[model samples]
Target: MRPSTDHPVDEPGWGPLARYVIAATLARTSDGGAVVAIVLMVNTSGGSGWLAGALGACITAPHLLGPFVARSLDTARDSRTVIAAASLAHGTTLAAAVLLYPHTHPAVTAVLLTISGLFGPLLTGGISSRLPAIAGPSQRRQRRAQGWDVATYGISGTVGPTLVAAVSAWASPATAALTLAAGCYIAAAVIRFLPYAPAPGKTADVPRPLRTLTGILASGPLRRTLYLTVTVAFSVAALPVTAVSSTHTLGVSAAAAGILTAAYGLGNLAGSAGVMIRPSHTEADRLTTHLAATVAATLLLITLTPSFPLAVTAYAAAGIANAYFFAATLAARNEYAPDNARGQIFVWVGALKITAGSAGTAAAGALISTSAALPLLLAVALTIASTLLSLAERRHNRRYNAPCGPASPHTQPENGRPHPTGPTDRIHDCSNRG
Candidate 1:
């Protein structure tokens, strides 16, 4: 389907979209800040570095359960209630962890943080899955809203750690944790005011996990998009380690890593802003492949540059490509995911990316002592491989005459349901192609 060219004046859902962006940004900031706050809290409390690391892991590991948790959102009679409850639970657990750290065993604190992490996806993928409804069925508006959503990630990444650091420096790490928890509570309250409703009859027959998995596997575009997203996430997750090592090689203090990382985050915000101002007109699948190649090229440039300034520029450029790539991936999911399984697809893909990122971080930590350039090289190779895989899949589909685009006007909607004869239903028709 062609991208919507509807003017802003024609899109009257800005109020709800604004509320969503605000709530999502707050929740995301809490999620990102909590990690730093927890680590600092543990270290400043005379805990071992290993204990701090373990506590941080407790906050991240349960993100793998995102898909199952998101399934509840998909089938819920009212997703807002589920989302609000999850946010409250996440905040309560984080607060508990902070308050009990001095009085409880490290294992006990870890368990509390793990419970907090279990609801983390509701702040991310769960919020994202609702954008379609909130954006009110205009593809252009939805795309713009998505760009705003991407911007929140960039904003939170920069703001969250900085906020934690400032708070920890001024007051204490425990105070920082409490501040982030309060943000979560505010996000939950904002969610309560969002103008959203579940699609009628969409959840009447809850889909089995196996059925959702089958649907994901059957949709070629969705599968390819998820593959690209995971590969890119895995590659990008090594950036922090690589940046630190690269700065050391350039005879800079390890603290220079922060400057380089911040540059990338700023670049990400720029890219997202560009998308919001002018949503891409290109097909999402094609845009995703192009962006992936751009990312690989930028990473390769980083490896070739010996000058620190040039390296920083390369990192920023790579971030721009990554942002655009992520936006395209979101568009692909919107286009190819079955309506009944949309929430699950978003959450499942998010969970897989988190798992891949953890593995990538571990691999980079293991290999960075060998050479600063090694991790970046690995990233370049993985991104290129993912792009090639997507191209190969597209070629095979073409050879088999299995087009992944929207169904033809003459084609009938599945199950004899009366499909809307409008561009809004284009995604539904594309899913039927599977």
Candidate 2:
């Protein structure tokens, strides 16, 4: 169990953090590379774009069940065992898919991708659930560890595509897929060697994944966090399309679009660095409001800007706001979620974001031909609506006397026992956790 404290860990070390970060970053990089590789492999093998799209859907659709797959770790004797198995399984599936690619029907490739996608949660949320154990047993250290984890997320999203593109440029798409498969195995080996620590009270009577998800959604803070997540997903999904549209409007080459995208990536890095240096003390509700407002304002500016430079600047600032929004939501999850169900909550949140973002992306694509600025305008409207909803939610909570933190009174405990005395014990102080 995590030692209840408001200070940094006594023995500060980066060994375990480094190990897990490498493993996770490599694993995710493989995931990112495989997507591009799969599309290339299908297209090169005389398959239509529809086949490639179907294969991509196969790979990502299974992530909707990520929480259920991640629940195995919550119930396992040692989560490392499950993580190792998942990593190996992911690699094996990818290898099989690559080997059978052009020789087999697209259905066969889709099946393999679906099987591989089943392990996505282990590479992400499962690793994250171990942060307290990885960083030593203190809240402050855990927060720092999570910061590192978030940084890896930002880095992976950028590095993963670059690695795939580099390998594909040097060799065939099939070869690139094979390389990523090897990376999965290497990540599995690294995870296997890390010290194993069971989640707090591993023997606790954990509820089913669906039940845990339901309990998490019952909390005021978590609900607000989720609300923010949906809005942010919708707002950010328009970036790529908007970048392309802006490039067209400015009569610039594709390089300009890439530059705008890179600006967002740089802003993400900057925001993550700031969070690592000094964590925020704002309430989750207030953070959500600010994040939504910032996104809306930036998108408005981008829409109104006549030059590419101004658009790029606005996008970068929006990216920073987006990163901080995620940081705030992540901290709320850590503070509010019971340890035993943390993996489930994390996976569910990710799934929700992915689903919402996919919808938003599709919408933006459909509308971008009509007007470049139309999607941005829609995003602004959605964000404002979300902010208003969050404010209304807070008022309802205060009116009916909801708990201060995310958890409700009947929320399950990580230690399989009743919560400690005092109302505060049931309500975590998210704004003051440091």
Q: lDDT for every model?
A: 0.79, 0.74
- Can you write out model 2's per-residue Cα lDDT over 1-434, one digit (the tens) per residue? 33223232335477667878888888877766677888887887788999888887776778778888887777887777788788888888988998898788768888999999888767776677666566664445555566677777778788877877788779877888888888888888877655566654555566688897777667666677777787788778898888987798877887799999889888887877777777665554466677778878877888888887887888788777777777776766666667677777777887778778888889999999999889989999998888888777666545444435555454443333222222322334443221
Check candidate 2 and list the clashing pairs.
none
Per-residue lDDT, model 2, residue 187, is: 88
lDDT value for candidate 2?
A: 0.74
Tens digit of per-residue lDDT, candidate 1, span 258-338: 888887887798888888999886767677888888888988987888888987888898888888888887777765566
Off by over 4 Å in 2: 1-12, 137-140, 202-204, 402-434
Worst 10 residues of 2 by lDDT: 416-425
